[model samples]
Target: MVTVLTSGLASSLMDRLRRAAMKLALGEQPPEDLPMIAALALADGLESPALVELAGLSRRDPPADIRDLFTEALAELGLPMPRVEEAWIDRMLDAARAMLSGSLSPYEASDEIYWCLCHLDRTDRVTEPMLLFAGLWSNWEDWPDGRPTIEQNMREAAADLLRSHGEQVSEHE
Candidate 1:
């Protein structure tokens, strides 16, 4: 029970941090919840050096340099800080892998698929899982029976991709 709860908390924290980092990367202000998020990391006992650097900041102290440093800190914390393009691809890959692994549901995967397709062009980073995701998403309305085959293909492709290209989330998380 404790392990599950901790894993859930870490996953939640990683999501928040990733979103904030992406916004900063895109020349946007950090989320209003940034301070609270840092606090939660400390509360959860992740007192890593990178996090300590963040813990020293005042809410109003951020600037463009801060944006770079913020992403750098995430990298130091063992997060896979991808470029915006690769980030979407990574998210898509994660959704498929998690769905196959039973860590996420198809309902959740659908939302992930939608966001990835929105960000990604059809001509690039066309991984096998992406192809399967596109097919599964487009035909879900008319082909209920197709879910099994698509999911089966997804399971195989996602497993193979995960072996070679999956993000290595921090153990501290």
Candidate 2:
């Protein structure tokens, strides 16, 4: 009997994912509605780039179709978009000053002040970019509870989420 190694199992799974993605690409049916579908994929822990590519392959545009819904999603979670300019510096500086005087430490204040900048860095003004950006880079020291190498961790999280929802992540190319 031929013993299938772990790599063999992974290879088999990847092949299945490829087949599924190809099927979607060919069928042109796509997943369900846009935001929910994208949200579902996000919940499944799919990275932003993967999600974007998958969406492109599946031909879905949840965010574009429902800007209100996307905005609602972000607002519901109290996530603010970053708007940077010299005009805003005074306000930010004031907040920084207040934080400095208050119990918040410089490190904490700096983090809060740079939070939006970080968001800008992550998203490049794109909705899906932030998640993958954050998820991929979240394991760094600058990020909370970040480990040395957490790409696999992020992928596993995405996979587990998708699996729990009865969704499948196509073995990426």
Best of the candidates, lDDT: 1
List TM-score per model, in order.
Answer: 0.60, 0.19
Error of 1 at 161 (Å): 3.8
lDDT of each: 0.59, 0.38
Residue range 25-80, candidate 1, lDDT tens digits: 44454544455565666676554565655656667765544455565667766676
* Shift in Å, residue 70, candidate 1: 2.7
Give the lDDT of residue 30 in candidate 1.
59
Error of 1 at 72 (Å): 4.8
The number of clashing residue pairs in model 1 is 0
Clash list (residue pairs), candidate 2: 34-62, 44-158, 44-162, 45-158
- Per-residue lDDT of 44-105 in model 2, one digit per residue for the tens? 43334433433343334453444334333333323232234321332234334434345554
Cα RMSD of predicted structure 1: 7.1
Give the per-residue Cα lDDT of candidate 1 at 58.
64
